[model samples]
Target: MAKSEDFPGKPRNAPTWMSGVGRAPAELPEPNLRVSVKEMLAQQQVNEPAAKQAVADTKVENSQAKVSGKVLETQAPNGVIAEISTTNIRVSPFQPRLSFNETAIEDLANSIASVGLAKPITIRPIGDGIYELVGGERRWRAHKLLGRETITSYVREMDDALAQILALTDNEGQEALTEYERGKSYAKILDSGGERSIRALGRRLGVNHSIVSRCLLLMDLSNEVKAILDTNPGLIGGKRAKDFIEFSNEEPELLLQAVTAMRDEQWTQEHALRWLAKEIASRDQQKTPSKFTDKEISGIGKVRVDGKKVELRCEKTVDAKRLAEHFEAFLKTIDRSLIISE
Candidate 1:
């Protein structure tokens, strides 16, 4: 059965929202049928209890273009030098220089005051109307000292690897790098695959392939040797590090001895090279295999076989399982015909 209102033209079968039974549907909150997970997270983040609980949960912040390049570059774009507000620019966390020279920066500031900045610093936008420094920290400091509101900067969009390399190379071009800093930077570039190969890295660094190779060798120095050099920032150079690494590869113990000698005597590079030569000769004499037994050295263990006999002397401290595995590996390498099986 149907019922009609006797007032102004109204139907009893009118839609629920249109009916005057209660408030209109549009007045109530809409259903979240099409709400996304991100929206749910935002809602949770807004809620006090849910937000607090989320702190303990393992949360992964997945971002795609929030920290993008093309849009950031569009502000200044290629070959465009712009004057960005000083306060808006942030220092780069990836800057290679560990400590700034106060005296040198002061001198630079005085010069800049007299002649003005010769060049603009390089930077890249990192969203939110903020920019990150790519290079020229010294110049940035000078401008900051002068209480200038804004300084000239060249803006570019780059990835972490490219940003790091450019920051490193810019400083390198203007100033020298410590051996540790240079080697580590070179290693980072090589490992990051930013330049792809040694030759490519060399080209960017304005060095020959051999020089690039030697710089990387500095990283192979033992921790003990590095610790000694750390105490004196410029105690040794790249060439010396090359000789040290080669000597260490031949005799690791000799490296420790050489480090002690260098620190105690304050030996120059020439003196150090002479010491390395002597150490290498000494190691060669000791490591020469004897007729009675041949000694095999490895990371795991040192073995001496008694004239092709079953007698074996193992010196390295190793677990029983590891020793057994090493023995099995050695056995596998032997000619199969030499084995007698049932």
Candidate 2:
């Protein structure tokens, strides 16, 4: 067996898997990965001491108690890497991440094909010969690309709360996860029987408390807005998301308008924010009646609203027969708010 290695990066609870693996050998036409599973395992087993020494040499003084506890669980008391069938592992259902960059994953698959997996994914045994992933989904995915039957992993007993914490902390470290994704994770953690408060969640995420709060608001974003954000990530962040959400509250149509502008105009975050703010302002401006609004009635004269009531003024040239028609037209222009409030 090869010397065991840890996962390449931190943990995230996002969803991703390899697509090309399901293809038949004829589709590949030739070998993809350079080494056989047996050879790779042997190489890892042979390099164990060097890997451990490297870890020891790089180790720094650590005082964070929470980190220490989690770290202890990641590696067993004897510190040996274990292997199990890939069929036994199940993706975590509570994962907060919904999207993954396809290009990045493909590159990882290519790397694994050339050399082999550098790090083992973390998993906790659930039952019935199954395990749930705690971290290193991408690595698991790369292994899937190799079409291997077994995966190298750190196996341990973990509760839902600790699994969640490990997944969030690991994910937040590696990529620019959408604010919506991160927020959804925070909401899930909160939903996990109060294991983490907003402040505690923020501390774990290494973000401000307000940032955590803003991410939660993402859950309230209209589906249209979220779909747009999903395809165009840098298009919105927590702060910009708050702007779109505020506009949505004013009038749901206003949020839709922002989505349309963002899609059709290909707006930058600044452009979208500015447009939403201005549109909301314009709609707000048109809402309240000023001192008076005049609607001309052509032949009959004009109707004026002096805020409280409608006043009809007639010109000497107008006939009285058209009076009802003009009055009906003026009714459409009347403020419905006062009537509704009553």
Candidate 3:
């Protein structure tokens, strides 16, 4: 069963459909086989009236239809769980998952094929006969994978911000979700104004502040690196993302090269890190500057001397004739022979 604190701002009486939080699916009650003579008489007396009342109740329920458009609906505690057409159900734009594991989804499809869907997906009616998924996307995909036309869904009411929060919370800590993807979701939640700050967001999500802070560091990555993550999020782990971000700032070009190699050559993060280290070390070893001497002459600006060549940068107000005469006398004092042809 879901506790109110599980969803910080959720209504007290609302049904909890979020993954791993809600009450167990209700079970059908066993039928009473034995009948008493007096009980049978009493049941017969009320059956007619009960039938009439049920008809009236259904009319009211239909008037205030639980979900828009036509869907086979079953009532739950506070909402309706329906068998909705898979085509009409769309993934939420606020969904945090960037990629899905096909093999895992196939395994799920096989399991569902064997035992049926254990839990229905949660969604919200988005009008025009469309519904937006809130959780259980894997199940939805499995259903699609099986070519099932309709899927069991629990339809509820929630806005984009709440949907995002629920989506993030539902997928957090799952084995398939990469830390880079998690960090990206965190950035979206923060950008959406769902939380005022990282601490507040962590408190709301029941996540540790340090973990959240470390994850947020991935957002500082360059756009190119982020694009790489968009396709291959598992390239770097959350713990490594912090170190990677540092390297990206300190050695941007090298980081890009390493990440590009990871994408193209299918290099592991460990391999990429090792390659980056070797390249940086090799670069440092190969860097050696040419020997030259620079001196600032009092009123004649600066002079630079290399083995056989000397350059004089004259001051703004120095007379050209005076500068030439000064260099002529200065050249005569040199111990080595001067090349004066030019």
Candidate 4:
């Protein structure tokens, strides 16, 4: 029993086991932690006031250990800190963030390896020995990277909705999650029957209603556009995504072409807008008749050429077979293989 006296920066009121146990081993290759429950119990020399009482009152049942007068249970009262096995924790199904930055996770792992975890992850007991992550996935991942068997966690009692909200709030504050991801999170909650309306959902999550509405709007984007956004989350913002959705409604085929070009060509929003404008103008220009010629032929009723289309109104008495023969002969003069008929 090293007692709280041996651990530097130990909280005066904390039990001996909780104080110095937070530090990770100096070397990654070593399986030993700075302090292990078995090693601490081996000494049997508790000295601190709280540590003495905690050990005296300790109890064990169903493979659950009681230390500091607290039990790690699924129905335990909220706000308990415990050292738990990493293998027993499960990722939350409500995780809104789809992508994690590997470089950032690596940096975090290196930092934790150099200096022990500064903050404990938040989790809620879900079963006999299983816990579901509420927040701090990055920290959990870092602990995994260090090959640690256990992690320090702040345990809580929360329902699915609360757990999901906390997870979103945690990541939103820590990193730059794209607006699309944020919106997707909002949509999930709404779809889960958690909130009645965007306004209510925003109020519950403490986000602006407009922002929530914008995020939901992304759900309406074409699958093609959504696929692009999935891989490149920062491709277009909520406002721009709305623009795309609206443009797609007007000209889906043309918009898909432009969106594909936007991704491949690395186009700026302004460039894409300009390209769309030019293309629309060119199409409209083509529709306008730029050339027209009308003349009365001696044998034929009349001849007219409008842009690329030509029409002839044969006189009522004109021979239909003769006119067809003449037209076929005229087309042959232009190309020997030319033929007319359906």
TM-score of every candidate relative to the true structure: 0.52, 0.58, 0.65, 0.62
lDDT of 2 by residue, 198-277 (tens): 89778876788998898888778777777766666445675567776776677677667767776778767677668777
Q: Evaluate model 2: give its lDDT.
A: 0.68
lDDT of every model, 2 decimals: 0.69, 0.68, 0.77, 0.74
RMSD, one per candidate, in order = 24.0, 21.1, 18.6, 16.8
TM-score between candidate 1 and the true structure: 0.52
Highest TM-score scorer: 3
Worst 10 residues of 3 by lDDT: 60-69
Worst 10 residues of 4 by lDDT: 67-76
Residue-level lDDT of model 3, residues 79-193, one tens digit each, is 5666678898988787777888899999999999998887778888877778888888888999999999888777777767788888887776444577777788888888989
lDDT of 3 at 22: 65
In model 3, the runs with Cα more than 4 Å from the true position are 1-65, 68-72, 173-175, 288-342
The worst-scoring run of ten residues by lDDT in candidate 1 lies at: 65-74
